[model samples]
Target: MPAYTPPLADFTFLVKDWLKIDALYQSLGLEEFDAELALEVIEQGGKFATDVVAPLNREGDEQGCKLSNGQVVTPDGFAAAYQSYVDNGWNAMLGDIEYGGQGLPYSMAVPVHEMLNSANLSWRLTTMLTESAVLAVTKHASDELKAQYLEKLVSGQWTGTMNLTEPQAGSDLSLLSTKAEPNDDGSYKITGSKIFITAGDHDWTENIVHMVLARLPDAPAGVKGISLFLVPKFLLNDNGNPGERNALAPSALEKKMGIKASPTCVMNFDGAKGWLVGEPHCGLACMFTMMNDARFQVGLEGLGASEASFQGALTYARERLQSRAPQGVQQPDDKADAIVYQPDIARMLLTQKALTEGNRALAMLYAKYMDIAHNSSDEAHDNAEAILQFLTPICKAFMTDTGLESTSLGIQIFGGHGYIREWGMEQLMRDVRIAMLYEGTNGIQSLDLIGRKLTRDRGDMLGITRNAFAELVAGMASGEAQQHASALLDEWYQTSLQVKAFSAVDAAGGACDYLAYSGYCLLGVLWYSMADCAAQGDNPVLAAGKQKTCDFYIQRLLPRTAAHKAALLESADTLLAVEGSEFDYL
Candidate 1:
């Protein structure tokens, strides 16, 4: 296994060079976040990840989580590590100050989260769920709810979970059978089984707060009927101390393919006492407050996995002596040259770096927008929030998909050693694979992107991004690489408009299917502008690397957008034509 090292140089490039982190810092009102501070935090983050968390990655995976005497125990050393996290105040970095939190901006926490994910994804999942739960409680839960659960959750003393899916309802909320019958006491009795609940039960915490989605007895059907509830593992008294188990327990922990160290349990909510957060039948909206954040977190997770795999594989390639380069008479004195001598290996490594780094920049930029959306609450902040909404699915879907690709490529670069469990490359592959599936599958992400995001307003988001790109390009039309720049800018504008046209009048109908085929185009458009920013940079090395990556993207990656469009233009029947029963055997 390779030592986990944060890509500090590349982080600097993305922040200071590419996205102009100074401006973002000012935008988020963090006047003190200068280069020194940013570098210091990143360095400290690297040390914590490498020294404290990385050592636990393998041990956690091997120890997994255990159920003994009706209590779920985390892997050895997890309790200490989690306490270290709490005592150090890492959990409060992205939270609000009013709720026993530090109130540091998310721009700082995003990379920290990235390091944790790369160091130990299973351990990181626990933190990820905790963050999401806190955000949800902060946004919608009443002041009373906050007073009870906020401090402990913010301090990472007791973790949190979201209970959404059930055996009867995976993605379709209309099919949900979970019943929330109201009591005269203004609370409710939640009776349902929620599946795939991450961190559902763990000894790392004193109690678990589950943000459950269920339906009231008199509520309307479908999504409109859903309501959010705060269901705790133990009943809390007026002082917020755990009183007793509230009819919720881990019926069984899922034996998963990856992230086995984090318990994904089938939680049985058998007449659990619950407190409703926000209004009745408004649960989905409130959950989105968290899901959107979780979706972006998934993107960061994917980037971290890809970055880790690349670093490990790159180190292995540099050390392992293999066959010489394609050209003959290479390394005549030695047994063979290192794999680094091979251009293809370099190409793979560079491509992985390009994607991983680009995704990092994108994720941080989105996090910056999140801070603006939540804290600023102005007109410009509102627009940025909408843009963030449109980009969220793409970020979540593309990063994870590319992550799996990059991890697989890293494995291929190492040959049989990559597949071996000892080298840890295989674990990266397995772990990264889950991001593509969780936080709504990539297919679901695409459907949401087109059906909900674009079609609802007929190119509303597309228009915003296109107009911004054009305005930027227009400003730089006469600057360096003007010819390529001017032409691509026009193409981007045209592509945006064309995709807008792809949405039907009842745009939300089957265009979602079309989006599955053209999701890559949206990603390309975003990356095109990003690469353009870096390509037009002042630094020699970074500017050249950005230009090359953009060139590689245009030459090899952008062509996929064409296939995506063509597939979109394919009849809707291309997808619906396949009967579910017909494919059951396959």
Candidate 2:
């Protein structure tokens, strides 16, 4: 296994120096959170992730999950690790205070989650899904439902899963066939199968709460008929304990390419006892609450994988000697200098660093906005919510895309060794590939960004983000950093106009390119903000490194926006001109 170390320094820089989360907490009246408390949580969370959780990562991957007679068994050490995670109260870190939780701000939870993901992504999936489920239930479920399930889930005594994907219905929930018939006791009998259900069946928790999407008999067709139901693995007894088994079981575990330890189960719900969560036919809206949260978490998965890959590649490059440096040998006594001296190797490493760091900054900023959106009472709340809506898809798609690239670059850095299992770089690459596919694919995210967010709102969200970026640019010193920000803002404004115009013609054809363009521009803004923060800080070395990374992103990576913009602006006819049957000639 690759030695995993949480990037505490980076977290400190982001939360403390760059974003100054203390001010955010004060503004939002999050009295329990301060810089000291936040750092302490991060430090302790890092230890748990590194000591207990990370050790299970390689073991889980090698052993995977086992199924026997409908019962799914996790790999050795996993159950124990999960117990430890629960014992430490990590699961309840961000839960509601009314429900036996610490009620920490989401911004404080961001670093902790990043560390957990970095340590063991497969293990982290269970926790991530459960957290999302908790949010959905809290937001939409009735008081009675909350009284029954919230406390246990918040306490980590029970786990949760979101069941949205059926074999026939992946992204298109409108075609779902799950059936929910009204029962005499005012409950519902849910009978259907859901595929790719992460943590669907695990031995770690006594009861698994499945937030399922199904249809009523008398309901309207398509998505309008769908309803959200809370179906547990064990039906609650009169005393509210898990009594009789619900008519739900894991039919099979997916033999996937990566994250083997995380059980991707095909769940069969046969007349399972369940209760409606939100209103009938409004399940899609309720489910979006969960999906949106999961999307941001998935984006962090990409950031986490990239950080892990970078760590592995950086360690290997510094130790593996190859040829002399172009200038001179830094280590003259050795047979050859380390590969870190090579320009191309440096390029790959720096690119990974730039993307990972910039993504981290953006993710943290997004989390801060989430805190404001959820907790703040000021006039900024509306703007914060809008920005969060706008950035969620970009964060989900762009971060994961860069994660895949960074992990692949790790393989390149390791050459032959990276291809093999011993180095552990290959696992990072394989595991991160799914982040783009699940929780709404990157293509789906692109369409959401262009068709719904940008076009439907007449660039209102984009205008909000642009104004914010403009303010940031205006505050900066008049130099290269300010100039880069100005140029990016100009390009962003012009491209938004072009995409809005072009999307009117063919929304689907230009959506992906437009999203890519917006993603790069957003990252550029983040990089400049980081540079600006560093320049004002007292730490000279850290400031210098941040400046260099910012310059690299501006010079090398940000220019990719041009290609995406051009593609977005091109007439859809270029793509539509190629008929479906013409490819048969190949």
Candidate 3:
């Protein structure tokens, strides 16, 4: 296969032309964010992905994480590469400046993350989990706690892990049984086991900081009683050096199907000494602060893997010889034409391209939301925050779902080569599968969209998306950009209205239940809005690709909304009344 290009031109078109991220940065009052810097960052990220990380992906997956004398050793080049990442200050891309970070907008960090993940997801997982820890501390940890531990985490000197899942509680925090008892001075002694902890215990860093969830001795039942604790593998003394060893240890490493390079450990917190990150009984809410950021990051991971796979598959499709062109039969003199010459093959390739391009645009749009939500000085900040809250689950669930599907298509595009591990296409597939499962599973994401985000806000979220789309359309109605953006907006508006009607009906199920099946409609509106945003760009091939993908999504992808409409309004009976066991007969 040919060396991978980062699709910089496409990225440029999306950020500079289509999304007009400059406008967003200006809205956020971020003076440092601009076209030149963005291009430089993305170009550097691409180089890092293709050169340093991509080479190690296969090696990491094959070597996996080795268990030795209770120490989890990562693959070769991984620890050095992680240090390189920290030296480059990549982990603190959007972290707090007070903690020695760059404090870039999440928008700026979003695509940078995509490029990094695309280059090599396994290696990037460590950096990503580290950022999540930074978020947790930045939001909830105290000045004293931050002063003691924040610098190392932000600098990536010490890695971090979220200890939420136990043997019984995967997604349900209510089922958690971890315990914390008060110490004389205010610290707590934590005891319990956490399962599926990513980067839990590794030799990569001198110390590991675990953001653990546990119940106090006198705590009430369920989530409200839960508290967040900063439990490090090795305690930090006043001088910030590794002190007495903490009791937290990896009882065992999991054998997951993918991203084998990053260790997933079942942690044993044996009366481990820990400090509360935020106030007790308020941990879950504070943790929500990090969850949204982590969810969006997961979406980018899926997008990156899909893109890398597509790039590999596209190269293979264009060069590999296959059948002759249909019937003028112009390739009669040659042995055969490349597979790219086939219409069906072209359709599949175009589909992957369409989703990849659209997915990137959508990711940046969500990041743009993040930039404004955090940095904006205007009153519009609240509105932007609402929009981000509303759309985040969609971004996390929808983009990743499309990303996984696109990668599967990328594999199919490679046909035989896609299935073989030697071609490296299968590794991308294995790596991306986890995106749908982690940072909140897609099913839970759907429930969040319909149950919490859409209805609980009393259509505030609906209003935000509707108003934004209206303004985007209204901007082009009299502007010079109308020629390119007008029709797209009109179609999007009509669809949005249809979605409202589709959601408004109190079907046999509740409103939340209605949208569980109809969340895809909400996504249709979002995807089309992004497609419209992409339509405004200048570079013709890139713009044409955007326009084509936008149109194809509407024509090909949006029609699923019709079925959703049917399912939401008229078919509720068929849905719930269906025989549960008959449908699942053994």
Find the candidate with the highest lDDT and give its number: 2
Q: Worst lDDT window (10 residues) for model 2?
A: 497-506
TM-score of each: 0.92, 0.98, 0.91
Q: Alpha carbon lDDT of residue 451, candidate 2? A: 79
Model 2, position 237, has a per-residue lDDT of: 88
lDDT, candidate 3, 1-586, per-residue tens:
2256788887776677656778767756776788778888888877877887778888888999987888899999999888887888887777688888888767567777888888788888878888888989988899988998898899899988888998899889989999999999889999999998899988789999999999998778889998999999998777888999998789889998898988999999999999998988887887777778789888888788778877887888878778786744545667888888887777777777766766676677677777777876466787888888777776777777778887788788888878988888888888889988888898788667655665455677767865765565555423543443445445444543444443422322433333333334444444555555555555566546655666676577656655655554453445556686878884
Residue pairs with colliding backbones in model 1 are none
How many collisions per candidate? 0, 0, 0
How many steric overlaps does candidate 2 have?
0
* Whole-model alpha-carbon lDDT for candidate 1: 0.78
Span of 10 residues, lowest total lDDT, candidate 1: 505-514
Model 2 residue 277 distance off true place after TM-score fit, in angstroms: 0.8
lDDT of 1 by residue, 35-74 (tens): 5677677778778888888898887777788866667788
Worst 10 residues of 3 by lDDT: 504-513
The CA lDDT of each predicted structure is 0.78, 0.90, 0.76
Candidate 2 C-alpha lDDT tens digits along 451-492:
788878878888877776777678676477788788888888
Report model 3's TM-score to 2 decimal places.
0.91
RMSD of each: 2.9, 1.3, 3.3
Better of 1 and 2 by lDDT: 2
What's the lDDT for residue 111 in model 1?
Answer: 82
